[model samples]
Target: MKSPILRLDTMKFTYISLLILVSPILFLSCKGKFNFSKQKAENEKIVVQYGEHFLTDRDLKLILPKDYTKEDSVNWVKTYIEEWVKKKAIVDKAEENIDELTLKEIENKIVEYRQDLLINAYNNYLIEKNIKDSVTDEELFQYYEKHKDSFPLVKEVVQFRAITVDKSEENQAERLFNSSKDEDFDEVMKMVLQAGNAYHDKDSIWYSPEYIAAQFPELNQNDQLSQLISRRKVKISDENTVTLIKILNLKPKGSTAPYEFVKPTIKNLLLNKRKLNLLSELQNQLYKEAINKNEIKINEN
Candidate 1:
C-alpha cells in the first residue's frame, strides 16, 4: 500500500483548532446536537487517507479531549492518524485474504449481534416507558427478613465511638468516653473540639477491623481489639496522646449483615425482580396480540 497522504488546509485547521481551544465548554455542550454525518458530507476535511478509506477532521475532533494543549493536540492527532491508517490497512488485508466461507460467517455474526442490540434497546425503552419503580422500605425489610442468611458478613464489623486527647486529659476524656448517656458524649465532643483534639462518634455506621485499625493504629498494634458481645471501653496511650474507644456493637464474620447495611442491596434485588416480571408480561402480551391478529400462524403436521 502507498504511504497514507496528509492533505490539511493550515488556515482552516488553525481556525477549527482555535475554536476548540477558545471555548471547549461550547464544543462539549453542542456535542449531542452536532450532526457529524451531515457536516462530513458538506464541509468536513480529510485528515488522512489510507488506500480507499479516509478519516475526517470531525472524527479527530470528537475523540480529542477539550482541555488538551496545542502541543498535546498535535501529538494526539499524529498518533490518531497513524493508528487509523494501520487499522484500515489491516481491514483491507483481511478483506483480501479471508476465505468466502469465513467472510459469510463473519457477516452472519455481525447481523446476529446487530439484531440482539436492537432487541435489547427496544426492551429497555418499553421497560423505561411502562414500568413503575416504586420500592418501599417495608418491602425491603420483608425481603431482608426472608433472605438474611444469604447476606453474611465476610469480615468482623464494629460500631463504635472514639476520642483522642492529650495524655494529661486522658482521665477526664476516659470518664466521658465510658459514659453511655448522649449528653456526656456531647460534652466530650465539645471539649475535644475546643482543645483541637480528635473525636469520632459514628456509632450507627458499621466499620471493618481494617478501618478501625486505620483510625487507631495503637489499638491494633498489640491486637488488643477482639470480638465483643457488649459495649467495652478500650484505652491506648502514647507519649503525648491517648485514644479512648467504646465498642458499641460487634457482629462476627459469619453473622448476618445489619438490615441498615444491606437495605440498598435488598432494594436492588426487588427492583431487578420487578423488571424481569415486567419484561415477561410484555413478551406474553406481544405474543397473544400477534396470535389474535393472525400475525403468527401454527401449521399442525
Candidate 2:
C-alpha cells in the first residue's frame, strides 16, 4: 500500500488527468512558462497560501514527474496547490486543538524523521554511486545453481503461434498453411496473415497456457492448449471463425525455466543482494575509520 502522503499526491494528479481528457484545446491554452524552479527563493511566487503556511510554484514543479508537457505542468501545479491547501487546513486545526507539550513532542518527532529521511537518502545516493550495476552471465549461472529451488516455475507455460480468422477465410488459410514449408516459415506466415483476422508468428517469447487462452478466449484451459501444442497445426472451426494454433516450443509445468528466460529476474535479485552486502561493508568501515580519527565518541554509562 502507498503511504497516505503519496496516495494524496496521486489523487491530486488524477484531477489533472481528467481535466486533460475534458478539454485538450483549453488545457493547451492554459499552458504557460511552467518551469517553477528557475526562479530564486526570494523571487519565488506563492501558488497556494494557507494563512501562515504557503506552497510555492517551485515546490509543486519539483514534485511533478519529469517529461511533463506544458498542459500537465499547469494542471499538476493547480492540483497540488489545492491538495496542499486541504492539508494545511487540517494541520492548522490540529495545532489549535493540541496542547503545547503534545505539539512540542510532535515537532521533535518530525525533526528526527526529517533528519533520518535526509541521511538515508544521502546513504542510498552514495551506495548507488559506488555499487556495480551489471551482473555477468557467469555470476547469474553461479547464483542460479546455488539457489535453484528459490526460483520455481509455478505455472504451466508454452511458446506457440496461432491465427484466428472468419469462417469464410478458413479454407484459404488452411490451403496456404499446407502449401508453406518449415524453411519458408516466414513467407508462409506473411501469406497466413492476410487470410486471418489476427495472427501471431512463431517467436522466442514464452506464454502461459492461461495467458494464451485469455488472449484468444476460444481455448478452454492450459491442458487443452498443451495437448494441441505438439501437433504441427490444429484448426478449430466455429460458427463465426476458424482458429489455427501451432506449437513453436513448450515448457511443461514443474520444468525449470531456461537461464535466458530468467536472466533479468536473476540480475535484479543479485543487484539487491550486492547492495545490501555493500551497505554493511561500508557502514562497518566508516564506523571504524570514524573511531580511529576521534570523529565519533561514546560516553560510558
Candidate 3:
C-alpha cells in the first residue's frame, strides 16, 4: 500500500498535469470574456498572485513576444512573473497605506492623461487623412523671406572648398588648388582621396567657421582667424601636412541666415501652421454640425 504522503504527492502531480492539458482550451473559451477591470472571476487560472491581484496565462500571452525561442520564452515568462508579483505587491502596499483622497487625485490624473492621449491621436488621424503633405519651393521661399528676422545667424557661416595633403606633395597640390579649371579641382580631389587625407568640396552647403578650423589646428589657434574670412584663398602648413582652403561665400554672425541653410526649418514651420489651421476648421465644423443636429443644447437656469 502506498504511504499517505506518497499518495498526496501523486495527486498533486496529476492535478498540475491536468491543468496544463486543459489550459489552452480554457484560455480560448474565456478569451472573449477577459475583462481588464479590477473585478476577476473566482475560477480563472492564476499564474502569479499577489494580494487581491493576479496575472492569468491569457494576460501573459497578450504581452509576450511571439518570436522568442523555447529557452528565451521560458526565461522571459519567469522574469515577467517575478516582476508582475513585485509591482503588484508594491502597488497594493501603497494603496493600503496611502489616504483615499490621494488615491482619488491619482485616479483623476490618470483620467486626464487618457483624455489627452485620445484627443491627440484623433487629431493626428484627421490630419493624416485630410492634409496634403507637399510644400512648394515658392511657399518655402516666401515663408523664409517673411521670417528672415527670426533666424539670425548665431555663428559665422561659410561655403568653401578645402583640401589637406602630405607636406611632400604640397607644391603640386598648391598649383592644382589655385587653378580655376574643373579638371584641376577633380585631380586634386583624387590625390586627396588616394593619400587618405581630409577634403571638403561641398561648395553649396554652409558650414560654421569652427568646423573648418577643426581640420586645420593652426587656423583654430590663430587669434586672427576671422581676418582670414575675407581671403578668397588660404594655405596653412604644419610639420607633416599642408591644407589649402578656398572660400566660396561667407555670412557674418547676426546677419540673416542664407535661404538654403534655413529651408528645412521654413518647411517645418509651414507644415505646422497648416496643421493648426486644419484642426481649427475641424473643431468649428464639428460645433456647427452638432448644433444643426440638435445634439448641443444651451441651458440657462
Candidate 4:
C-alpha cells in the first residue's frame, strides 16, 4: 500500500507530466510566433513596432502566458517600449561621455555578437542535416560494449553498526559480551544499537560503508572497520561506557549491468558522437576553404 505522501507525490508528478505535454501546444495556439532562424536583417520584413528609441515585433511572443491575460499583453508591450526608451536614454548619455577606446570596444562587441549568431545558425542547420533517427538497439548495444565501464550498475549498499571506544571501557565491554553470550547474537546486536535515549531498528541502526567512511573519517579503512579498532585501543574517560558495534546486515555490491539496462543512455551518447563527427567534418571543410582563399591571416604581434 502506498502512503498518502507517496500518492500525493505521484499525483504531483502526473500533474507536471500533463503540464509539460500540453504546454507547447497551448503556447503555439495562443502565440503562433516562433524563431527557428537566427536573428538577421532580411530584405523583406514585417515591422511590428517602431519608435524614436527602439523597435520591437508583434511576433515577440510571451513565454509566460499563464501568468497574464490578453489585456496584460498590451500593458507588457507599452512597458517594454518604455523600458527600451529608458535604456537608450542611458546609452545615449554614456555615448556622449565615451572616448575613442570605448567606441572601439563597442564595435568589437558588435562583431563578437555577429560571429556568435552566425555560428549558432550554422550549428542549428548542421544538427538538422546530420542528426537522424538511425540509432538501433544493436547499435546501442555495440556502443555500450565499447563504453561499458563509463556507467557501472548501481551497487547494493550494506548496513552495519560500528562502535569505537578507548581502552578504559574494556572491562565494561567484556562484561557485556559475556552477559550477552547466551542471548541470540542478532538480538543482542539489535538491543545494543541505541542513539541517545531511543533504540533505532536494526535496519536503521547502521549505514552503508561508503556513507560511514565519508561522515566519520576516523573509522580508518575503506574495506573493513574492524581492523582499525583492534590495532590501537585509546583511553576512554568512563569505564562503565562500553564500546560495542553491530553488523546488522550485509548487502553485497551488484554485478555489471546488462546491455538493456543502459540502451537509451548509450543511444544518446552515440548520437552525440555522430553529431560531433559531422561538425568536425564541416569545420575541416571550412578550414580548407579559408586556407585556399587566403581569408584567414596570422599576425605574430
RMSD of each: 9.2, 10.8, 9.8, 15.9
Q: For candidate 4, give the lDDT.
A: 0.51
Query: Candidate 3 — what's its lDDT?
Result: 0.74
Using all chains and alpha carbons, the TM-scores for the candidates as numbered come to 0.72, 0.59, 0.64, 0.45
Least accurate 10 contiguous residues by lDDT in model 1: 1-10
User: Model 1: which residue pairs collide?
Assistant: none
- Residue by residue across 123-192, what tens digits does model 4's lDDT show? 7787776676768777787777787777655753444444433455445544444353535434444445
Report the lDDT tens digits of candidate 3 across residue range 131-217.
556689998898888889999999889998989999999999999988989999999888999999988888999888788777666
Candidate 2's C-alpha runs over 4 A off are 1-40, 46-52, 60-105, 123-133, 163-181, 184-187, 190-202, 220-233, 236-243, 299-301
| Model 2 agreement with the true structure over 1-301: per-residue lDDT tens digits | 4433343355555544544544333223224544432344785655443455655545665677666654565566566656666676788799999999999999999999999898678767866787556678899999888877676677756677777766776676666655546655555466556764678764577777777778766566445654575564567677997778876667766788756667789998888887778767777998999989999877898
- Residue pairs with colliding backbones in model 3 are none
Model 2: colliding residue pairs: none
Clashes of 2: 0
Give the alpha carbon lDDT tens digit for every residue of 66-116 in model 1: 666655666666666566666766887998999999999999999999998
Tell me which of candidates 1 and 2 scores higher on lDDT: 1
Candidate 4 Cα RMSD (Å): 15.9
Which residue pairs in candidate 4 collide?
none
